[model samples]
Target: MATVEVDQDLCVGDQICASMEPEIYEMRDDGLAYVVDGMEEIDDDDLIAAAKDAADACPVDAIIVEE
Candidate 1:
């Protein structure tokens, strides 16, 4: 399992994370990306892959994954 973390300070509200991994990452009212439960339910490999991909693609490099 992977825990997703987003750095609000660096996030640019790009929505890339939400597009890449809807189940794992979401856009809050603040217009920033935040993980769902930090995406604790994302145990499937595909979902994890998408989440990781989103993290890697974040322009601000604000996502952090912990296994």
Candidate 2:
């Protein structure tokens, strides 16, 4: 399984993660990116790929994926 996390302090609210993976990422009211509830840890291959893609797409590299 992979753990997905977003560093709110570093997030610039670009929404790239949310745009790439809406099911796992979202733009919160604070104007930062965050992993959706219940999606912090991912076991599915497709979801993992999506999460990784989102992490890579983050301009500020605020997204972290731990396997």
Residue-level lDDT of model 1, residues 17-65, one tens digit each, is 8987788888999999888874754567887788789888999899987
lDDT tens per residue, model 2, 41-60 = 99999999999988888888
- Cand. 2 TM to true fold: 0.96
Determine the backbone clash count of candidate 2.
0
Q: Which lDDT values do the candidates have, in the order given?
A: 0.83, 0.92
Model 1 misplaced stretches (Cα beyond 4 Å): none
Tell me the deviation in Å of residue 28 in model 2: 1.0
Point out the worst 10-residue segment of candidate 2 by lDDT: 52-61
Query: Which regions of candidate 2 deviate over 4 angstroms?
Result: none
In model 1, the Cα lDDT at residue 4 comes to 71
